[model samples]
Target: MMKDLQNKTIGVFFGGQNPEHEISIITGEFVIAELRKMGLKVIAVYIDKNGIWYSNKKISELKFFQKDYAKKLENLSSCYLDLTLSRNKLVLHCNKFLSRKKIDIDFVFPTFHGLYGEDGTIQGLTEFFHVPYAGCGVYASSVSIDKGLTKKLLSSLNIPTTDFIISYRHEFTSNDDSLIFKIKRKLTFPVFVKPARAGSSIGITKVKNADELKVALALAFHYDTKIIVENSVENIVDLTCAVLSDGSKIVTSDVQESVFGSSDLFDYSMKYLEDGGAQTGNAESNLIIPANISNKHTEKIKEYSKHIFKEIDASGTIRVDFLLNKKTGELYANEINTLPGTLYHHLWEKTGYQINEVLEKMLLQGYARWRESKEIHKDFKTDVLNNANQLKLQHHSE
Candidate 1:
């Protein structure tokens, strides 16, 4: 089955109208390179920030983007996913009068990070086109993006999470005092405010007082209408684990500690914009594999990771983050990255597997899941439509 998949064409999609667009481009390039190494026919599908889709061989190389090749119209061609076709295909054209080109794709490897990309938008599109996608489905992607909703879902399963308060933009703007008073009354000082639906820690702030909270709320609201404020955990250490499933069995990777050292918080600056340049693709270098935690903690994190993946019905490779107290042994799940940066390739690599092997497993798993979905009885053999009755209209005729 896996060998047969190597013969199919894969569409590598990246770049979107989100803050993580640049990172998505890097990830897309990495994925395209890895897929090509497996001797598969891969097509580059680049979606610019303006939501314009372009397909061309030149778009597959990173040097093209480094030189701003997208701005040159002659170097690229406009393309769109044709949903009218039975299979997922990319339609390329110069103009309506010109002959259009079509590229048939059997699978899609979406590398979108935030907003429409990871928030179920791209996954929904793949479903409409009837193609096997490489990550979570629409339901899981949408649910995982909302921090508040993810916490609620985990809490229902008896999972631990920090106490949080949800703040809406309208309420914060209408009466700032009332909202702040409620937050202070319910939670203590030194809270973390984050955009409800965002990635890369784009709009996150740690507030130590009411004055700081006000500024943090403004920044967070700028990114998303909904915001989540959680009581800061004492002596917190970031830990992350990745899970992969083949629709039946699920496996987890080793726990990796995110060492922030003296930094107050792991903001966007620390993750990407620090040092010389962006560290989006090289983030794994900062992680400490087999995190210096107790065996009990490691086992617990692995179990929780698998449980959360199954609970959310996530497919492909998904990474789950956690906040563990160094002083205490308490652990809480932070959030689930449906499409983690670099596909969490480092975590899987630590488990004694190469990138190609891991990706092949994901592709086979996604295809198997897609095939299983087709086995379900979507259209029941019922006569409800044929046995329907007509109703008379009861309205004044003009």
Candidate 2:
């Protein structure tokens, strides 16, 4: 039935200049692996940190990520898509000197994460290119990627989220002490400070007192211009809920609880360094089946999740993170990961769908969005372009 994707030259586009660059690579590689498993012909396209694009042979090798990757990558030829011209087709202009070799891409599966990629930039480019892409459109991606914007939109919809002190970089650096006092006065200590636009908890810090506030601010501002510090959720337990869509409808996966080590919060080391389970290294989460929570709680979270999805007009698959106050059992939407890890395939795996199946569904959604977008048109046989004399006279008069 889905024969259109068979050897369709799908572009598995990932990698870029973001703090989440490495993580994006992991996700992109995993998505490509799954796509290949479905027997789909994928043209792996990578956007390097310097903004150079690579494709074909250079993309398949995982070792291109080694310490001297750029030097190694310099040899394997480069490619780029010229959307500056008419983007009605997937023709890629290799290089000016070389004969233009147009890549006949069926669709683009953007597995990019963090700033420049997730913050509506890449999505906007795709829209201009008129290319089919996985996940939300430009509006959803922009609103949902920016934490301040997302919070305002969600709050307007009555979505429950933590009360936060959203601070901008320029203002905070001027008066850190006064700002800290304001936070201390308004909200209690043990707050969570994070860069507004990051994921995987890269620039997130748990500050318990005034002493730790400065350090946390410095760490967070390194990643973003704006920072948000949420009043501590007494007994923070994270609940991650994922939703998959094929544009027409959404199917949710089971809620999973992330249990932390008793000693401290799940720092980067605890989350990723743990090599073996129950060991000091190799980050692993002890996933509790069904979350060991009441059905009522599950239903509340699931309902709220779907509501947020529809309200934002988000499509494709998204993972909405929530933090549950251990005492109150309240679920506060932490943030929305627009392009979540491995598209949150692990969550679906627990729900009976394999990686290949999930990838297939996402591709279908991509193509569906593409087909639907064809209904809109900004083009027309305008008399202005046809009558060059009229346009020239209008410009001169203005």
Candidate 3:
């Protein structure tokens, strides 16, 4: 599969009209570098904050996203996938000369983090064109991206997740007192309020009492219409395990425990801004690989991670986070990240797979999934269309 990929052109898509756009760009750059190291041809596709797409070799450079990025975009061509083209040929149309406008791509590696890119929108676009892309498909992507939906699905599957109450912007606005009453009645204080669809902890607040509940909900609603208020695990340790597949066997990476700094929660600044940020490779210090937990907890985390991965019908790679209550020794599934930052290659690395190996496996799994989907009979024999006139005549006679 790796050898076959060398002969094909892979498009690395990153950035978007998302809060996690910068993080996605970093992931794209990392993946592109790894693919290129394996001698694969890579096309860097950058989606600006305004949701416009551009393709250029310079996009792979970090400097292109820095100062005066607008002027730099003038040198690049804005591109879009021409879905009207044949399935065998995925053509990326760009605003350039006719000869240079169409770029053929055999596969896609989406490095998007949140919102439109990670929440099944881009996955649906690729599925519409019948193009092979990395990470989970539409269903899994859609389910995993929304916190409220993800929790509901997991609860139905008998998976243990932190107790959460979902609130909508309209409902909260119309009856703020009712919503607040429900939260006060159902859950205890010191709850975590989060935007249902946002990632990278962009719009999250830790509410300690009723006085802070309304403010937290308002902040969350600023990012997304729906918000989830989950009961806080007082003595909790954040553990994450990544799951990956090579289209045959599934494996889980080593569990890593997140060590938070002065922040009450692992907010946006802690994730991307502290210690020179994730792009500079210094933020890794906050995560402890082979987390200082009992072997039982580690195995259970791995088991839950794999189970959730299969249950969601996810392909490629994913990371499942858990909140382990230190006092009770209970673990609650936090959320599933279909497209984890940098694909969580760091976890896989500790689990004995190189970054290149992880990329190869992801690409191979995506290709195999696409091939399997092609085998299903899409053209079902139906006479309804042909007999429409006869049916109409019969109805008129009756």
Candidate 4:
């Protein structure tokens, strides 16, 4: 027990300057909603697209986000990024309101996705502030969000993944034909190219031939500087397995497959708010709960997901994606979402854990991590402050 966090203010942080800002809101609101249901005092921290922060009672409502809604937020309290050891507590920069109104966060649940939000910058702030928060620590969040880093780490661990290659903007700018030829030679046609540091299918493209590779690269490069090209999994079922960790052990969720629309390639729209208007099939997109896959495949995915979670030193929960080619039965682990969509509670809900229980579990995990850090000894006997004069004298003598 962290002693201070019991029934204290739990901040559900969401939104950022990333393209996934709206989706982040959806995820953040889910967490906030669940926390409220759990009887926890929750604070909704909204980071505007321009990086401005806000935490107000009205933020709890979903429609506060309608385009002309900026005016509605006029009454909401504004927050600023101090970039110091003060992430948990947002200081009221406005003097008049500073005295009476202050938001002190006892805990943080960062539901922000992509770029600065989930890329370890916010996690670093929480670490500096020494506050309990849910999701992976700084290091894990950093590696997991970076595609190149994740592939390297997973490859080093001897995990099976799709064949791929990286291309630098400089190389592409040079109009390197070898890049295309090399990709075609090593991997078959129908390649998957994505921005190395992006999420939510923002910059993912499936190319049918060498001609489309260039266009895909250009599109993906618009989102990220680095390019990760992988072999497309034809006739494959894309699955996501969410794993939760509490240090002692990690638990796995039943494998859930993504059922895309008519477009063989699942793009941004198919990902978030499926445009097919097929709500019935969406039920299939959800977790199968004790997935219908063979025990061998389930075990393999579960073990792989757990290993990736541990290899990344991931805390809280992480959703690891995988592609299993139906024809060949070849399994390749895809990217890991450090701050997975909606905390992936839907998958866990099948295990008798309600949204409230999920919130509590995540909170407990966050506090446990914070408490573990406190257990580490960092005291020093020497008085460096008092010895400043002696140090100056020694430097002068030297």
In terms of lDDT, the best-performing candidate is 3
Give per-residue lDDT, candidate 4, residue 212. 84
- Which candidate number has the best TM-score? 3
Which ranges in model 1 have alpha carbons more than 4 Å from their true place? 73-75, 86-97, 275-285, 381-398
- What's the residue-level lDDT of 47 in candidate 2? 84
Structure candidate 1, residue pairs in collision? none
Per-candidate TM-score against the hidden true structure: 0.93, 0.88, 0.94, 0.87
Q: How close is candidate 3 to the true structure, as a TM-score?
A: 0.94
The lDDT per prediction is 0.83, 0.76, 0.86, 0.78
When 3 and 4 are scored with lDDT, the better candidate is 3
Candidate 2 residue-wise lDDT, 106-167, digit = tens = 57788888887877787787777787777777787877887777777768878788888788
Give the worst 10-residue stretch by lDDT in candidate 4. Answer: 275-284
Q: RMSDs, each prediction?
A: 2.6, 3.7, 2.6, 3.9
Which digits, one per residue and each the tens of the lDDT, describe model 1 over residues 1-398?
Answer: 77767678888899999888988988899899998998888988888888888887888988778865557635566776555664543333432235677777788889999898899998887777667878889999999999989889889988899999888999999998898898899999889999999989899988899888788899999999999999888798888888987666788998988777777677777676565222343555566888989999999999999999988989988888999998988999989899987787767888876788778777877788778777777676888766654442223332
Clashes of 3: 0
Candidate achieving higher TM-score, 1 or 4: 1
Clashing pairs in 3: none
> For model 2, which pairs clash?
272-283, 273-281, 273-282, 274-281, 274-282, 274-283, 275-281, 275-282
Query: Per lDDT, what order, best first?
Result: 3, 1, 4, 2
lDDT of 2: 0.76
User: Where is the poorest 10-residue window by lDDT in model 3?
Assistant: 276-285
Which lDDT tens digits does candidate 4 get at residues 161-224? 8878887787777865877787888888788889998887888888988888888988888888
